[model samples]
Target: MPNTPPSPRRRGTARTDALLQVTLELAAEVGYAGLSIEAIARRAEVGKHTIYRRWPSKAALLMDALHRVWTTDLDHRDTGDVHHDLREQFVRSAAALSEPPIGPVYRAVIAEAQSDPALRAALDERFLHTVEQRTLDRIALGQRTGELRADMDLTFATEILCGGLYYRHLLTTRPVDETAIDNLLDMFMRAYATDPPPPDRG
Candidate 1:
């Protein structure tokens, strides 16, 4: 049987993936400060216009590349134990934020966002908002299931949970290690668990 040639759509998708992969490689090698569309084009063996047609700027290209490499779902799982689910998700995220490709690319985008209002807004809309909402959904599930205090302010709770990790990951030299994750979860459970911990027996 004769083989069929790939459709233009398939070819286009393959090209897009190849471009994104090259973007990630360059971003990792040069860091965001040194990464540029021209560099990407040169490395990918494509015209600069090809990349610009797909992505308006370096920030947008890097963001897509980061998403491609960081494929872990940002949503928390329904393990019936919200704490466990949150911890599981956070551990995964913390590792990504601490490690290569995703970590460095993400950090670069974030650093650039600090000075680019449009990039900041895109970052919030595409990444931060999705993470925050997924987290809040998990917490809301806990409340509905009677695992968490219904009266707790979920917005603030979500911020504390997500913000603390990012703060340590981005702002401080401290690693978002197991100890930090456990402490954060402990504090959150203490503040929001429906059943308070037993009185100290020590």
Candidate 2:
């Protein structure tokens, strides 16, 4: 019996996903700065023109790849308690980062972005912007619910908490464990919780 070929749309999606997956694996192994179109094409078993046809530059391809992997239907439901919700979401994020390829790939992308302006812009526009807006909205919701201090600078507070995660991921080998998450929340509550007394030191 003869086999049927995939439709154009299905074939395109499959190819694109394959390329992105290879890109991420290479990024993890060698860092973004060390990856090249030739390498990606070879690894993906496609010609250079195949990649160049879709993305004009490696940065553009990576931008799309990062968004594809990291910005899909993330869990952001309100749990009625801001601290519980934030901790749950953050722990999930930490766990995702700990997964093979993702952790090193993300860190490599971020590290490369520091020295590459175009990549940095792409990272901010494609990935960071979406996450930051969601975070700000969540913080605003927490304030409205009186869980967070009304006067807290939402952006700055978000930066401190989120920045700490990135810092630990990129700079420190410390595991993003329950203890680490609790410690971060402890600092956050001390600084931003609206309760008169500080949140329990636990």
Candidate 3:
């Protein structure tokens, strides 16, 4: 008997996912300069229409793919220990960087964004904003609960903690490993996350 074809929505989504997957692989290997809709379609084994139907352009497809792989809501807590919670934040954040292709793609995107304002804006809106807002909110929550000092500046704390990875991931060749995460948290705590001292003993 003859086989039935998949539904349009299903087929479209599957093809788009495949295209994005291939795009990510190739982008990591050779950067965005080497990516093209036709190349992606060929690698994904889907027609160009499948990709165009899902994404208006390659930038849209790539941005969506980046978002697709990002793990959301990994750092929400009322654990009452800001130190441990922040440690977990570093650990969870490193999970994204630790993925082999993800790190390269992320690096490439940052480099690509330097010249492409459109891509830069897309990244800011789609990825950077989410990261910034969630981080501020969680740390702010920690502050409200008295886990972090009332005067702790969420902006500076976020920068110091988050900036550590940015330098390692994109600027330097070294990978953002567990040690880096721990050390960063250690320094951050030393500077801003430390506990208050007890009163002098008699």
* Model 1 stretches astray by more than 4 angstroms: 1-14, 45-47, 73-75, 196-202
**Backbone clash count, each prediction separately:** 0, 0, 0
Best by TM-score: 1
- Give the C-alpha lDDT of model 3: 0.72
Query: Over 4 Å off in model 2, which ranges?
Result: 1-19, 38-56, 196-202
Q: How well is each residue in 1-202 modelled by candidate 3, as lDDT tens digits? A: 5788988999877756666678888777767777788888888787889779767777777777776666433544546666677778777768766676676788677788899998888887777666667667877876666556678878877767667678777767887888888888777767764377323222
Ranking 1 against 2 by lDDT, winner = 1
Between 1 and 2, whose TM-score is larger?
Answer: 1
* Candidate 2 Cα deviation (angstroms), residue 79: 1.3
TM-score of 1: 0.78
lDDT of each: 0.83, 0.78, 0.72
Score residue 6 of candidate 3 by CA lDDT: 84
- Each candidate structure's TM-score, on Cα atoms with residue i matched to residue i, is 0.78, 0.74, 0.69
- The candidate with the higher lDDT, 2 or 3, is 2
Which window of ten consecutive residues has the lowest lDDT sum in model 3?
Answer: 193-202
Candidate 2: tens digits of C-alpha lDDT, residues 13-83: 98888899888777777777788989999999999998999888887787777667765635656877778
What residue pairs are clashing in model 2? none
Candidate 3 has which clashing residue pairs, if any?
none
- List runs of model 3 lying over 4 Å from the truth: 1-22, 41-56, 72-78, 173-175, 194-202
